[model samples]
Target: MERPGWAPPGVDITTPTSSRIYDYMLGGSHNFAADRAVAEQAIAAMPHLPAVLRENRRFLGRAVRHLAGEAGIDQFLDLGSGIPTAGNVHEITAGINPEARVVHVDIDPVAVAHSQAILTGHPYAAAVAGDLRRVGDVLAHPVVADLLDLDRPVAVLLVAALHFVPDDATAGAVLADLRDALAPGSHVAVSHASDDGRPPAGLRDAQSIYARADSAVTMRSRETLDAMLRGWELVPPGIVACPAWRPEPDDPPSAHFPGYGLVARLPHPA
Candidate 1:
């Protein structure tokens, strides 16, 4: 697979990437044949994979809106933010408050490139290439530091991203570092794939397919998801399925989605 001129430098276009595969699942065009092939295989195995991805995306929008409107959060750090698609963090928060700042971080060079292109000339939003596990590198990124004030309440979004971490201890430590770095009023919104509602065989197949991608998938139990958000106060309707989290009246039922979402806040100091 020859690299296209549009692809960012240092990216291997031949191998499937989680970010690009996710973009393809969300109906975005930044994916290659390799990514689409893997995504299609997962979809074939689970049939409801597209719906699950859509639900996850919708959860991201709803969570961001809640943070901007109800929680009074004006800045967002979207970690492992995939290819820029509909209802991006900045777009959702900007609707609530135009001046809201967003910093999108991803390990994928292609995702970063596409996001940078999409955010061109937009002063309040920017994208940076960084690993989510490297909490310090992500937070200290020039674009993140310039746009988001760490002293203020910022919403950290890990929507559909942490499942790719593949290591419990590393993921836990990363979350802890991020939690401790923010101000007292900051919020962390997370959505992770879960093995609760799916058949073991199908889930294993899906995981096997994703394992070939640049990042492997690791589905967690609901209890483990809850534990990941330790030290924070969970908002109402805590740690429910994707669509079950603050769903709108017309939102589709979440009967088939095997993902969980929650938004928790670090309490203000006494």
Candidate 2:
């Protein structure tokens, strides 16, 4: 299959990716036909899928705003930042402080390509292709090293990304490594759908669709999320449902979304 102009070479465009599927969910034009097909299947399974993703995206924007505005952070490490759509991390941060630097890392080459294309003239923002699970590689990438100062306060966003890690042990270890690497006053934001209890029939079908993707969705329980984020200090209204966390009045109503969202700070050295 011929690769789309927005897609970088050497990446498979015929296979659907979670990132592109998410792009489609958010009504972005960066996704391919394969992505739309899988998204359609998933949407048929659960019509609210798109709404759930939008709410999660809003959570990311709110978290970025908090980091750039109130937390006084100017550097952001956005892991698994899907195809940039409305209210991206850089966009949210730019609105608060134009100088705030952002590095968007995604495993999908196409997403990285699209980000690089859109962020061409924006010196403060760049995109790198890397897996968030590989903390060492991601933090050491040239883009990250140049754009972010690890010794200073930075916001690391894991918005709707952890659910793909699957194993709690691996997830906990990654978070611990991040905590150890970051300086005092750093913050991390996360949003995830828990799989502790029985899933609804529609959600079950959606999960089956995601299973075909390279990084299958592996929802963790709220308890597991807390366990992984143990060292960080929870911000107010801690770890609530996605839309419930510091929600703006203009945000759409989500009646029963199961995803959780939180922003926690790493305290200063005592």
Candidate 3:
């Protein structure tokens, strides 16, 4: 397959990446044939995959609004940010606070390249290539350090991203390091996929498809999900289904979506 002119250097265009697969699911055009093949297979196993992805995106917008509007956060760090699409973090925050800054980090070079292209001339926004599991490296990135102030309250978004991280220890360490890096009152917003209420065979099939791709999927129990947010104070309606967390009146009910969304805040120093 010939590489597209827009494709970033050093990225394996032949392999299906989670970021590109997700971009395809969200009706974006940044995906390749391999990503679409695996996404289509996963959708065949679970027809509701598109709806789930949309709901997760909505959850991300809602969480960002809360952080920017209610929490008064002026800076954001979006981990595992996929291909830029509608209702992105910077766009949502811009409406609430025009001066808000955003740093988007992703392991996928394609995603980072597209994000950088889209954010050109936007001084407050930037995109960098970094793996979320490597907390130190991501935090040490010059783009992140330049855009975000560790001493100020900022929102760290992990929406629909953590499932790709298979190692529990790495995930825990990432969260702990993030907590320690930010000043008191920093908020963490997460939306993670869950196997609860879904057919076992269907879930397994989807997992298998993702495992064969560049990023493997790992669904966690609600209890395990809750445990991952330890040491942070959960906001109201804590860790509920994506749409059930302070949903808009007209938002479609997401009871069938196998995912959880929550916002937790680190307490201010005593």
Candidate 4:
């Protein structure tokens, strides 16, 4: 497979990347043939998928706005942030505060490459290539260390990323470690795939299609999702559908989004 100019040196252009696939779903141009192929297959199975992804992106924008505007957070760490597309975190939140900084983390080299390229003149934002499951490495990373202050409030976004982590223990540990590392008043915004209703044949096929990609899908029940969010204060409209979390008047109806979204905050010291 010929590597496109946009793809990074170490990336395998033949195998489908989950990030690139997601990029394709969001109508972005950063994906390769393999990724597009997988995305098409998934779409064929579950046609509502593109709408779901768009809703997730909308949810991301709302989450960032709330964290920066309402919570007064200046630092942002977006975990598993897929390919840089419209409505990026920095664009949404950084204007509110001049000193605001953002560090986007993703496992895909293509995503890192595109993000770095797009962020060239944007001094306050950057991207790092690393697996979010390794909480220690991400926390200790140079980009993260430079842009984020451990003692200051930061919003950690896990948008559409947790489903790729198949192991329960690893996911829990990652969340727990992140919670312990941040200062009080920090917030975590998550939008996760759920196994609430019985999946149709097409949706099941979509899962199989993702299995062929770089990471397999793992949908958790609402109970497990709530448990994973222990020790945090759930804000109003807690743990609702993505659009249901905080929908703007012009935003799409919440019914299109089929997953759960929540924003939980760590309390300040009494």
Candidate 5:
């Protein structure tokens, strides 16, 4: 892998990064050779991996547009946001509502640096590097509070990234903290991978490969994922497979994206 000058010191160039692999899966050029190597191995396990990644990205765009346009949401917090690529949250949201505010958060330094480079002049957007498990700090971060009023509705997007959250309790608690802080009308859009349908042995093998990279691929079931949204009101088509989540009228129907996408609105306090 041709290492970039910006990569964190002592970072293992031989190890695959979840975000970088995701970037590669989306047919983006921002990833390195190590990321490509692991991603290619995953593709070998499931030839449709790239297609699934693209479909998920399209779903993210569609979900953001729906919240901004149809739901009148003007603020967003994108968690575990991977390396910036075409049709990112800022690009899609700003295109719809020029005044929309967004905070992009990720544990990946590369992702943060790339986001900063692309969004420097964008008055409505900012990026932060933080652990998603630290829900308190992430929500209390100065930039997030400055750009977004938690007392008002904001869209929190967790797309194609939560699978690394292997511990169910930790994942649920992190989400609950955010839910507790949101005001009435706030929304959360999440997409998580699952082993809902029959899968070959190779896909499981591919998931194992990620364990060597300090990441875990934990695929959940619909019921378990729905449990994560307990306090919020579900939008129509609640917790369906990714490709089926309010897909654009023009998008082809597919039953196997290995992930689920759902948007839920927080109810107002009495």
Candidate 6:
């Protein structure tokens, strides 16, 4: 992506980034021309790319609010948090409980810098840079330790991020590590790209476009995703279309969804 004048120094503008492309899809001004170009390529493959991204964001808000309100969860650990956008995990949770503490994690240095600048001194929020694959490092981070109390229930938000984890082994290892650290009552909410309800040929071009980006895309099957939730008890609706997880009254009725979302809780050992 061509660097925008507003972009900070030292950030690469040529490489196509998932975060930047996501920002573009969300109608944000933070993306560059290079990002927009790649995003258009994706849109060409999937006409509803923008709408799908928005639906995913909306689902994220609903999941966070549900965790904060119904589950009495006030601590959050958001992995692979992209560039901060409207109605992020912290925003949604804080709205429900002002005392809620959130730690946003991502591997992008640019994202870390941006998050730091915006969330610094917010008291309840902290931004830390780390690969989601490095579960040990993420859990051991001082920011995470200081903001989130692992002994109590917490909400782990993995919105539109985990699908980027290419290998099943790597993804499972990361999830297992997180599950081990979370309390018995902790909730895990995730939204992942999928091809379950569509023809197999529908995802080829989209996958190709993502292959050219900074991160590779991994569209998992429902069975694969379910296996990843081995110990957690699924909430109502189970794994369904992102928009269908819990649609708002104002949401348009459509079945052309591109992702799956669900909220689940860790079960106490018998």
Candidate 6 wrongly placed segments (more than 4 Å): 1-9, 200-202
- Candidate 5, 150-237: lDDT as tens digits: 8789899989777899999988887798888888899999888888778644668778876666587998998988888778889988
* Cα lDDT of model 6 by residue, 175-204, tens digit: 788788888999899999887765434466
Clashing pairs in 1: none
The predicted structure with the larger TM-score, 3 or 6, is 3
How high is each candidate's TM-score?
Answer: 0.96, 0.96, 0.96, 0.96, 0.95, 0.94
Residue by residue across 6-53, what tens digits does model 1's lDDT show?
Answer: 897877888999999988988888999999999999988877788778
- How do the residues 171-215 of candidate 3 rate in per-residue lDDT, one tens digit apiece? 777788888888899999999888887554477788788787887
Residue 201 error, candidate 3, Å: 6.8
Instruction: Tell me the tens digit of each residue's lDDT in model 2 across 1-270.
Output: 656665676888788899989988888888787888889999999888888888888888888888899889999999999888878999888889999999999999888888898999888999999998899899999989998999899899999898888888888877888899999999999998875566645887898898777677887778778888868999998988888899998998787786789999999867
TM-score of 3: 0.96
Error of 2 at 266 (Å): 0.6
Candidate-wise lDDT, in order: 0.88, 0.87, 0.88, 0.87, 0.85, 0.84
lDDT for each residue of candidate 4 in 248-269, tens digit (9 for 90 to 100): 9999674545578999998876
TM-score of model 4 (CA atoms): 0.96
Pairs of colliding residues, candidate 6? 1-34, 2-34
